[model samples]
Target: MVIVGIEPTEQNEVQNHYNLFKLVRAPNLAPNQVAFRIPPNVNKLDIRDYLTHIYQIKVVDVRTMNYAAKRPVRKRDGAMRGKYVSKYKKAIVTLCDNFKYPPIPDKQSLDEYEDRAEITRMNFRRLRGWKPRPQRINMRKKERYEKFNDY
Candidate 1:
């Protein structure tokens, strides 16, 4: 029997492992550069190898920035106290080819999402004895209404 395409080799199997490389949007970056939120342990060499080997993309350069974790401060004493946010690393990778960012969702899709959220909220209220909390009143609208009532 003959097999089609490149056969799975031991090397391929070894390179098939998963690594966290989340693509992030950075409007300030150049067309050839892309930003990614990677694990703190991942280095520039690892990023270059991963992109070249897995995605078959030529990486020109990789720059990494480490962000320190933020600690919660006490409101009363103005002291640092509470759980710390996890530290993360951001990688700005420059590619040989230009990369175009994906388009944003239109207004119709946003309206549909709001409708679905409203339905879910109503369902939750029906199942549980949930009361709608009072929302903050807009000062402009309130003043306009007051002026109209005076007229």
Candidate 2:
């Protein structure tokens, strides 16, 4: 004889998959983005599919990191005990070209957004090999302190 636990339908299974939602990381990646942390077993391909099919983001690139465990102090009853924290993985996905986040006027405002965008464009030009604008030399210097006199 065999026993099987109650099996939920496909839709029910998918609803259960909502567990992954809770695992996603905070979405505070810069002004125009967000991020998520998934299981280490998830590869770049899987991540791309999830972003495309689930979140619907046009991913420009994906960066990953493998964490390693570290030893901890040993402690016990009137003694010390040793332990280690488990390792995990992380990823950072950059959005593709032409993707733009909707206006966050409440946070950035219009003027602030334009200033930031201009600075960003300048930075990008620099990265693309643009030379820095020439700087003007300051022609002022403080005078040296005079000798102190005591009465």
Candidate 3:
């Protein structure tokens, strides 16, 4: 996987849309903040560079954790059902404490954050052509017969 850092504009959009944020393991921020997944085998220095260039933020520190791919489960047919999980790394980027974001004046309470999360969940609710249910073959045939049987 590639170690590309998410852009600041994109990050702001995501934050406005998802009400979630990322943070590093620095001494300033909370320890269990948001985490970003990086591609496997990415170099530490490259990740540092990405954080600075793409996010346009001064990274005070960076750290990563790697996990091994998990094996697939056995199927009833004596064959493996699914492939092994992909291996990836998580990067924790600690930004300079002076970093500041535009305050969300519209969101005055925690409930507002929850509402924003729900909106993010429904981001693609009005997509143009995203049909989840396909037309059944027999149903199509029945409709054709109905349309012509008027004679």
Q: Against the hidden reference, what TM-scores do the models get?
A: 0.56, 0.40, 0.43
- Cα-lDDT of candidate 3: 0.55
Q: Model 2, 95-149: lDDT tens per residue?
A: 7644333333474544466446656766887899987452311111111112222
Q: Quick one: ranking by TM-score, best first? A: 1, 3, 2
Candidate 2 regions with alpha-carbon error over 4 angstroms: 1-33, 75-84, 97-151
The numbered model that scores best in TM-score is: 1
> Could you tell me how far off, in angstroms, the CA of residue 63 lies in candidate 3 after the best superposition?
1.0
Error of 1 at 92 (Å): 0.5
lDDT against true structure, model 1: 0.72
Question: Once model 1 is optimally superposed onto the true structure by TM-score, how far is the C-alpha of residue 20 displaced, in angstroms?
Answer: 2.0
Clashes of each: 0, 5, 0
Candidate 1 or 3, higher lDDT? Answer: 1
- lDDT per residue as tens, model 3, 20-127: 223323345453333566567566786676556655657777778887888899988888877888777777766665543334356655555754654554455436
* RMSD after Cα superposition, model 2: 21.6
CA lDDT scores, all candidates in order:
0.72, 0.50, 0.55
**Residue 123 in model 1: lDDT:** 72
Backbone clashes (count) for model 1: 0
Taking every candidate in turn, the Cα RMSD to the unseen true structure, in Å, is: 13.2, 21.6, 13.5
Alpha carbon deviation, residue 32, candidate 1 (Å): 0.4
